[model samples]
Target chain A: MKYGIAYFPSKQIQDEVNSYRKRYDSHYALIPPHLTLKESFTADDAEIESLIPELKKIANETDPFNITINKVSSFAPISNTIYLKINPSPELQTLFDKLHSGKFSDDADHPFVPHITLAQDLVDQEYSDVFGSLKMKKYDLGDEVDRFQLLYQLDNGSWTVYETFVFGKEFV
Target chain B: MKYGIAYFPSKQIQDEVNSYRKRYDSHYALIPPHLTLKESFTADDAEIESLIPELKKIANETDPFNITINKVSSFAPISNTIYLKINPSPELQTLFDKLHSGKFSDDADHPFVPHITLAQDLVDQEYSDVFGSLKMKKYDLGDEVDRFQLLYQLDNGSWTVYETFVFGKEFV
Candidate 1:
C-alpha cells in the first residue's frame, strides 16, 4: 500500500482553498488541502502497524506551530507543480529533520520543499495559465497546525484517511 | 495547562458507558471514557508547539488496528482505579513503546498498562461497590482505533479536545 503524511488545514479554510484547487489541482477531490510532511511510500501492513507507538510518542514530544503563506511559487522545469510559498521557520525545519531521521524517512524522488500545493502534473501552458493569473497577488495568510493525518490510496484510486495524530499539548 | 492523549469510544458506546460511570466514577461528568496513550503532562506553549509536526508524522506511519476488551480489571492497592482489560496485542505494545520513547516519554510515575479507565480516585467503599459489580460482568467488545486526540485541562478544570489525528490509511 502507498501511504503519505501531511498537515491538513482546518475544514473551513480547506474548503475555501479547495475551491481554487478544483480549477487547477487534479488530485483536489482525491485529497484534502494539506502541506506534505512525508510523501507517499510503500509499506506492508505489519511494517506500518509497527510504527504507531513510536509515532504517538513523537507526537507527544512535539508542539503545535504556525506557518505563513507569503506567495505563489512552483517547480517549473523539473515538475510543473504550482504551490503556495511558506515563509520559512526554524521549527518547521527541525520538524522535517526529526521526522525524516529514522524509520519515517522521505521517499519522494523530488527534493522536499514545504508547500501547500495548488496544482500538479501540469504542462507549461497549464502552469502558466494559473501562475500568470496568480503571480501578482499577495498571499498573507497563516494557520496553526495542531494535528496531522496519514492517508492511503485504495485500489479504486481514492485517498482515504488511515490515521490522525494530534500534537502533544495545547500551548495557548 | 495539563494535557492527555486517549482513545475514546464512539458516541453511542461512550454514552452508554458514561451512564455506568455516572453511578460509579466521580469524574464521569468531568471527562469521558477513554484509553489513555499519554497521561497529563506540563509544558510551556513553545514546547507544545514544537511537537505538532512530529506527532502528525508518527500518526501517519502507524496503521489503524483493532483492540478487544474481554473483562474488567484494576489497580486495587496502589490506586482505586477500575478499568476494562484489553487483550494482549503486539500492536498495542509497540504503540505504547513508540509513544514512551525520547522527549515525549511518559511522565506519570505509575507503570504504563493498557486499559480503558472506568472509574478512578475511589474511596474504599466506592472501589468495592463498583469493582465488585463490574468484575463479575464479562465485556466482550472491540473497536478499531483509527485516530486519537490531544486533550487539555481548562482553567475551570474540565478537559477539552485540543486537536484530533486519524490513522494513516486503510488498504483493502
Candidate 2:
C-alpha cells in the first residue's frame, strides 16, 4: 500500500538541469517509452505515511546521487500497464538497484526498470500523435543530487513532497 | 491516483524457476507486485464500467502475446531496472517493447531492464547474503500465454478483473 520516495525523480530542483529541451538538436538516441512492470496498485493514507521515515533513512544513507533525466518514456500495450519513465543516470540507476533489489518480492527473476512514472490517472489513453512527433533531447538530472524528496498524494490527489533527506545524515 | 498492471517478477517466482537442471524443464516467471503508476489519475466507477467494453475492443485488436522468462540480470549503479540478459525465446520482450513503447511518455532514455523489481519498496535494507547462488539454474515463462487479464481498482482500494480477452479473440 505504501510507496517509497527513492523511486521519485521529480524531487530534483527544476532549472536548466531538469527541464526538457523543447528544440531538437542532435545527440538523441532512439528513446523509448516508460514500460510498466506490473499491474496497477493502490496505497492508503496510512500506507503512505508509514513509508516516510524509512524513505528518509535510505535517502540519507545513499549519498552523492548523480542524476540526469535523458527523456520521458511510456508504455501502452493494447491491454496492459503504462507509465512515464524518468531516465536516471547509469550510476544513479546502479545505486538504486543496490539499494532496492532485495527489499521487494521479485528479487531473483527480474531487475529494475529505471523510470519515474508520471501517473496521475488510471486510464492509458492513446497518444499516437504525441508519441509520433516528440523528439529526444538531452536533459540533465543534476550535477549532483544532494537530497531526495518523498512525494505523497494529498487529499485532493495532488502530489506534494512529504519529506526530504540530505545525504550524510544532515537532515535525517 | 490510478495505476496500471504490468508483470514484474518477485523473488518468490525467481527462486522457483532457477532450480531447473535442464533447459527442457518447463518454468514460469512469478508475477511481480503490481504497481500504482498514476499518482492522481482519474477513473470514475461509471467511467470504468463503460470503459470495459472499449477495453475489450482494444484487446480484440491487439496482437497475440507470447513470452518466455530467462536468465537473471541486474542493473548497475542501482537495480531500478533489470536487464533480461541472455534474453529468452517467445520474443516476449520485443512484443512488450513494440506494443507499449511511447504510450506512457514521449521521452525515455533507459532501455527496458527486463527483470521485475525484486522489492516494491527500496529502502535501507540488506542485500542478499546468498545472492546469485542459484544462477546456475534456468527457467521458462511457460508454454502458452493466451492473453493478459484486464483489471481496475476501486476508490476504496480494492481490485477486480474487469474483463478478459484472448490472444486473437476469446479468453483462455
Candidate 3:
C-alpha cells in the first residue's frame, strides 16, 4: 500500500482551495486540499505498523503551530503546479526534518516548499492564464494545526486517513 | 511515561457517563468516559517511539465495530468499579487479542471485560447504594466506534490523547 503524511487545513481553507481545484486540478477528487508534509511512499502492512510509534513520538515532542498563506505561487518551469504558498516557520521546518530523518528518511524529489495545491497539470497557455491572475491576488489566511494525518491511498485512487497524531507534550 | 489505549464514545454517551462519574468516580477529571482496550504500561521515549508501527498494523487489520450498552454492571468482588456494561462482538475481541500478543505482550492483570467506568473507588455502603439503583435501569444506547486513541498520563494525573488510530483496510 502507498502511504503519506499531510496536514489537512480547516474547512474554510479547503472550501477556498476547492473552488479553484474544481475548475483546474485533475486530482481534486482523489484527495482533499492538504499541505503535503511528506510525499507518497510505499509500505507493506508490517512496515507501516512498526512505524506508528516513531510517528507518535514526533507528534508528542512538537507543539501545535500556526501557518500563514499570504500569497498564491506556482512552479512555472518545473511543473506549472500552482499553490497557495505557506509562510515558513522554524517549528514547521523541525517537523519536516523529523519525518525525513531516521525511519522516514526518504529524500524529497524537490526542495521543501510548504504549499497546498490549488491547481495542477495545466498546459502552457492555461498555466500562464491561471498563474498570472492568481499571483496578483492576496490570500492572508492562516490556521493553527494541532494534528497531522497518516493517509493511505485507496484502490480507487482516493486517500483516506489511517491515523492521526496530535502535537504537544503530555506534561509541561 | 505510562501509555494506554482506549476507545472514546460519542459526546452523547460521554455526557451520560459523566453524569454518574462526576458524582462517584474519584478519577473523574483525570480522564473522560472510555472503554479500556489496553491497560496502562510503562515505556520510555525511545521504547514508545519504536512501538508505534505495530500499533498502526493492528489498527489497519481491524474494521470499525459496533458496541451496545445494555445495562449497568459492576466488578464487586474484584473491585468496586461500577460501569456501563458493553455487549461485545467478535471484532472487539480480535482487537483485544492483537494488542495482547507479540510486541505488546504484557499479560493483562484481569480478563477483558468491556465497560465504560461510571464510578470507581467507592466505599462499601456507597457502592451498594449506587450499584443498586443503576443496575435496575436499562440503557439501550449504542454507538459505532471507528477509532481508538492512545493516551498518556500528564503530571497532574490527567490523561490526554497522544494519537488516534482508525480501523479498516485501504483496499477491498
Top-lDDT structure, candidate number? 3
Winning candidate number (TM-score): 3
Judge candidate 2 at residue A57 and give its lDDT.
59
Q: Candidate 3, B1: how far from true, in Å?
A: 0.9
For candidate 2 chain B, which ten residues in a row score worst on lDDT? B21-30
**What is the per-residue lDDT of model 1 for residues A2-85, given as tens digits with 9 covering 90 to 100?**
887777765445655666677888776455667888877777889888766656666666788888887889888778888887
Ranking by lDDT: 3, 1, 2
lDDT by residue (tens digit), candidate 1, B1-172: 5777777765444555665666677766455667788888876668767665556566677788898888989887878988888788787776666666765856657656888777887889979988998899987788887777776664434455555666563111
Q: How do all the candidates rank in terms of TM-score, highest first? A: 3, 1, 2
Q: After the best TM-score superposition of candidate 3, give how far the Cα of residue A139 lies from its true spot, in angstroms.
A: 36
Model 1 segments more than 4 A misplaced = A106-110, A169-172, B1-172
Models sorted by DockQ, best on top:
3, 1, 2
For candidate 2, lDDT tens digit of each residue in A1-172? 3233433222222212112211221101111111222222245657645544554556556777554555645545532222234554665664555444443223323455655333222333324333333325434443465555443322222222233345554322
True contacts kept of each: 0.05, 0.00, 0.16
Give each candidate's interface RMSD in Å. 13.8, 20.9, 15.2
Per-residue lDDT over A1-172 for candidate 3, one digit per residue giving the tens place of the 0 to 100 score: 7899998786568778878987889887566678999999989879988888788789888889899999999887989899999998788888998999999966787778999999999988999999999999998899888888787765445555557777753211
**Better candidate number, 1 or 3, judged by lDDT:** 3
Model 2 — interface RMS deviation?
A: 20.9
True contacts kept of 3: 0.16
* Residue-level error in angstroms, candidate 1, position A138: 0.2
